[model samples]
Target: MSNIRGFRIQHDSLTEKQRIFIDDFSKRYTEKTKKSKNYISSNRYHLCDWMNSLGFKLSLKEMLYPIISHSSEGAYFTDIDGNRYIDIAMGYGVCFHGHKPKFVYDAIKERLERGFELGPQTVESGEAAYLIHHLTGVDRVTFCGTGSEAVMFALRIARGFTRKKKIVIFANSFHGTFDGVLGKMAEDITIPVSPGTTEGMVEDLVVLEYGSDAALDYIRKNADGLAAVMAEPVQTRNPSLRPVEFLKEIRKLADEKGFLLIFDETVTGFRVHYGGIQKLFDIKADIVIYGKALGGGMPIAAVCGRDDVMKIVDGGYYSFGDETYPDPYVIFFAGTYYKHPLSIVATLASLKEIKRNGNHLQEYTNNLTSILVEKLNNLFKQKSVPIVVHSFSSFFRFITVDPYPFVSDPIELEILFLLMILKGVYTWERRICYLSTQHTIQDVEDIVKIVDESIDEMRSGGFSFTF
Candidate 1:
């Protein structure tokens, strides 16, 4: 696997003239951290050393510092820096209460006092399920540790319930990091960018463009053995809002065609509304996947749906259920730490607060976001920049009409991302964002200001933007 050292350099915001400055800053940061921590010899890199040791990709390089440090936080930001920078990406919208939120942590503490786990049953898990059921009006939930696992169950349950294997998904929508749902981004309105995904999977998976009238027509014509039609009604493309009519038609088609409707609200669930984007869209699904900020920043996810649809894995039939322990019939869902009490406790507290406050981040932050989009768009227009501001709750994307990983573009997106990092803000390689409660109107204004400054600075470094 190609490591990130080169990736960082290419993605960094330094022109040849500015590279020396950034390199000097990096060296200073390293030296400062080492002296402060007073590390033994053979360990000069500090956080960088650990990251290099682990070999896992961290945020766009600049984020490496704060993540290790755990800076300003509460129900809002837990910045990596000693100072705060309004966390708009609440773990890409998962940490609803904010970084290491007191309520969540307090709940975890209470649960830890009670004992984190037992033979199997825990009060928090059942309570979490009950609360989830109440919130979504779903009949049952299968607990899992991440968005991908929940989605996998959803697919299997759909197949098992309908006795079908084909899944219909829309263009460029993401479910989880599983092999199944991760392929093909839209190109223009016609061509698509599909990486090494096998044609067979694509064949088994039905692909539809967002508003194509051909969707129902396609399903009507070829929904044979189709198990489910899954989507994030809030399209993950930039703004994350559902085309209102698009959602209604999808629901109509799924019903008429007798296939399951699945909503992968992994990103939008609680952030958009306590009821989720599905509720706002006036649509329903047989299953829904929740993650990102859904676990309030811990690793937990849910696959929930109507009861009749979720009975596929009843008792010990699947390998998971095949345990010979003389226990009552239990669906096999044992990760070494799925439903760890601490996470469940954190979830319970976070849900209570979210239900009470009701996704205030989206509401309070919208005006600021609108201002930002307007400002950024105007600046782009003024500069004739090719970038678009596909804004959503707190996060946004700057996708290229010319994109890659789906296409060949050695003029890597990483470089642009690094430029932003070199400017000092992290947006998770352009995938996720989390917001905190601490951001004031002033902070929002300042963010836009910083963006403008960053743009000008980047231009000085020879970057061009032509609307």
Candidate 2:
């Protein structure tokens, strides 16, 4: 296992445990050969079967298909039966380059022999940090294992730097599942999403509607004790809607009121444009939280910002302080997997891939948008399906507020979604498309065709169309 790329995989046979993983893989393959396989042998949310075995309910009905089990190699996805589906989710924009690009896989393989995390820095960490700082125009970075951790750190930095409390987040934008975030989440937040998050760890965080000017107005009168205003430049799950002047005004207000402005670019970072969301709009924030697209599908995250503000992360002064207020001001941020070598190596490889092919990828996304809209609109019209394909770059969400004659609404998009499943296309349960480099013009065409046919079939069955 250790001597991988430095040695080899073909000549190096697997150990008992890994051999078991492969053997179990073989058995699963055989079960796939039979049509009578159980729905899901494993799930993404709960790695262990303990939940189902102990009587918890399943969130989604779709079971694993060819069930290609793996977290990395260019992508982390579940493959149904024998047929391979190009994963557009790419770990939900984590795989910005593609599923397990060769460079990333090779980097991880090489690092295996170099030994893993040593509770210290490695050359790869510097390399990854250099890549991020160069692209984002930030002076320094602190690494962690997930987007939520990065956000958590950003809050600490904000409070420590400003000597204040309270974080301002946006409604409908996702940072990660954390207490600081759950207080104002679009998703269910009353119950703990994860085990460790307690109910009242952070109920003071505020969530404001993103497309509102009143938010800034409210902040003006209510800026006291506020530490940071964190937001996404563009909402990833719903890219069709842009905040326009509202975001710029937020930055202005944050500056005027002395609250740090943090942009959580977890979903829209490296992929939107190499320089990130700020580069596209000519606006800058006080602190930025980057994870998803930046890490290239690795388990790494970063909190980046101005040196003076970040310098407030002085250990004894803020995080581990004698002042003793549990003052969120004293909240120190640290993580075990901060700058893990494997993750850093993956991020470095992924960043290189993005820089090398930035223009081509942008063109690909632009062309894809054109093709999908042109073709899909016609199909939906012919079928009397009122669904509108709202797109931006490689991200899109097809939704219709109105109903069609014997057509599908948002609820009906679910049935329309099944057509996608049969056609070998997968979408988030939220009904948005997270595109990837693996998708081609043909994939777009195929999706349009399937959508048209599915809507027609549903309409024929007396379903009313919304458009």
Taking all chains together, each candidate's TM-score versus the true structure is 0.77, 0.78
**lDDT string, candidate 2, 62-118, tens digits:** 222333333434323444454444455566667666677788788999998888966
lDDT of each: 0.62, 0.66
The parts of candidate 1 lying over 4 Å away from their true place are: 1-67, 75-84, 183-203, 315-333, 358-362, 382-384, 400-424
**On a 0 to 100 scale, what is the lDDT of residue 346 in model 2?**
87
**lDDT for model 1, on a 0 to 1 scale?**
0.62
lDDT of 2: 0.66
- In angstroms, the error of model 1 at 295 is 1.7
Looking at model 2, residue 369 earns an lDDT score of 63
Q: Pick the candidate with the highest TM-score.
A: 2
